[model samples]
Target: MNFNQFKEKYQKFEVEEFPNKVTYSPLVSVLVQTYNHENYIRECLDSILYQKTDFDFEILLGEDYSTDTTREICKDYAEKNPENIRLFLHHPDNKIIINGVSTGNFNAFYNFYKAQGKYIAFCEGDDRWRDPFKLQKHINSFKTNFRLVMNYHSYITVDHNSNLFQTYQMKLQPIGNISGTQLLEGKFHPLLSTTCFKKVFNEIPLEMTQVMNVDTFLISLLGNFGDAIYLKNIFPSAYRIHKGGMWSLKEKKQKYLSKILTFTKLEEFYLSQGNKRLSQFYRDKKANTFKMAAVFYFLNLNFFQFIQNVWNYIKTKFFNLKFL
Candidate 1:
């Protein structure tokens, strides 16, 4: 669909007309999702609270009932910055557990319903926004490029284990547009902390709620509507790599399997949406995932698992595997 068609489809959500003098609503809504991030949540909140934007914005945080003092810390900040920070929507200490898996994203979904901004930005509890003018920059970029539905920048990676740090960007080239195909195939994605997107869609898709990489799914879904922007070298946020981090903490085998499953779901989604090109890319991604997982198992001397993967690979290669 063209830009006009996209606007007609998704941008029909009732919103206050943009005032010529900039006085209607907060230009953005900052979303912070936390779970046992007691050590780092304060920094995340501070980064947003101290941002030097002229426009008003709300800090919408959801603490998934940390076993530690994460919720209490957020409470303190809410009390201190009542005007800017909305009351934290938190889960109980005993979070929802379905079939032994944690299902505590209710607060995240809740934030979407409660958000009242033209644009929404994301920063996990463990990540911090480094640039105070991040929001301002994004707002300006959107103003200049009305075709862009999403704008994101590179980020800094802090490795707690190695005590090393470095800036990360998708490509060595200068800032440019990110294709919907790339986002759909899981080829590249902007870090959640560094992303800001227009609130064009009416509601989250049911398929999206079932994915592990919520941020990736969202950007790809948005990509379906319009193009996205990427800032090459500019660092707007810091993504900490720690032992307890969500996806980073998972075992290599588990992580690979998760990616395999996610890609399968994504492929199915794209096919259902009549996106054959992206769906084919997802098939390739899933095949590569299986190959990588097989290699890992072989390296670990897990012969049985390795053989199982080999058969799966052969099935996918020659005989159309129906793993899903």
Candidate 2:
């Protein structure tokens, strides 16, 4: 649907009625962090604004000095809808190069800290929900259990062009508990945008170390504190796939391969963070990662030039898998 259709459908959503109480659930703070998603930001913000939940909610839109008209569009929305929209413009005091690094974890941490809600939720600029009751579904789940993270599956990979693939439940653990080791073993949640958390976000310590892939580290910390519930009903948010996405397995094969190396290095440094069995599992997977990297690297390498390095590494380390 077009932007007008989306907005009209959103405005048509039925609002749920609520009973008066002395105290109420913490306002649901939805953080809509955008960098340069001028194409789909409206759909994202509209989805949140159109939620049929009875609980009060606010949006913290952290627009990171987008060069495109993303800032203008967001500002326009905030102006007419002043009560629910909180716009944070990321204007640097000292001029700096505007790389894709503007929407770092610090941006999320800072906005989340400023949120005056009891519960927190997130939606990316390039994604939107299909169901108007998405927030209400998660909020109702919290009433039954005050867990750290309340998650639901999403039908990702659909976009303006086509759907390359569909992910039903992107999270590694769907039925039971998930461990940090499972995350390292190539098992992980699809995107941080798939889940929402309690307003207990401030308790998380944000520092220099949390500059990248901070959501993984943050999820681990949250898992330590409480359980993460997963809803299984079939509604899913649309995740637009393009060059702008942080991690696209199809678009960034080389980058993804390098991440395997990073994961292995992290596993070694934080070895004590998980059990020995899980560490060993990742160690085995690390071997496969290296082998795949070698295969891809060798395919593009000069004949017999990098062959020596590849052969020596495989012979010296992965002797057992050599027969393959």
Candidate 3:
């Protein structure tokens, strides 16, 4: 559904809007989802606010009832920069639970629904954009190619102590586009924090709401619309690796389980979409992940879990069984 329809259906939650001073509509909406990110929220907001873009962009900050001072900080930023920031305070009860794990899906969905831009960019509260012209560069690429539905750049990883860990540069030469088929075949996967895509939420699948890794599903879904561009030369954004970070700090088993669930649902989703090849791709990925999980369990001396995962892998790979 469109933004208006989405808002009409889930308008029960309250939102605090800090109106922009500019009369022109925003060309890009930067979505920032945060929870207990008090330490990094300031830098995140500042990085976006510092962007040197000619076109107007609005920051849609979704603060998910942070237990720390994150909410206060977000409110302060919204009030001070009314022209750029629109903070949405979320309640704890509104969080979406997947497999008994609470997620920021509700917060993210609300921000997306309220976004008033042709293109939507994403950067979590813990990550910060390093390039001053990041948005301008991506917008330029989109404007030059009408078929491009998504664009992403390289990024650097920083450790919890704020030291540089690694740099992930795109290997594509001369900065070219990759088709949706390539994306589905695992030729390229973009970092969510470095991605900017066209706003087309009219056909968001029901499986998207059921999965925990919404970002991965979203990138895959965007590929269905058009090709994606890779920026090879832009200054890399910073992806923080902190102890409290969502994906960074997860245990290996937990990460494996999440991936398995995501792949299972994606396989079913593609099958329902009438893409048997893509469905099988995810099915194979799910089996591989299950095998890896079994190995991990064996290495950890968890015989029971190891046997369970091995059985699951056998069923998935040999019998074409589904987990969901």
Best by TM-score: 3
TM-scores for every candidate against the unseen true structure: 0.80, 0.67, 0.88
lDDT scores in order: 0.69, 0.59, 0.81
Ordered from best to worst lDDT, the candidate numbers read 3, 1, 2
Residue pairs in collision within model 3:
none
Model 2 / residue 78 / CA error / Å: 1.1
**Stretches of model 3 off by over 4 angstroms after superposition:** 1-24, 167-177, 243-250
Error of 2 at 188 (Å): 3.5
Task: For candidate 1, report its TM-score.
Answer: 0.80
- Candidate 2, residue 19: Cα displacement in angstroms equals 30
lDDT of 2 at 27: 72
In terms of lDDT, the best-performing candidate is: 3
Clashing pairs in 2: none
| lDDT by residue for model 3 (30-65), tens | 999999989899989999999998889999999988
**How much is 125 displaced in model 1, in angstroms?**
1.0
Clashes of 2: 0
**CA lDDT, candidate 2, residue 70:** 93
Q: Which candidate would rank higher by lDDT, 2 or 3?
A: 3
Q: Which residue pairs collide, candidate 1?
A: none
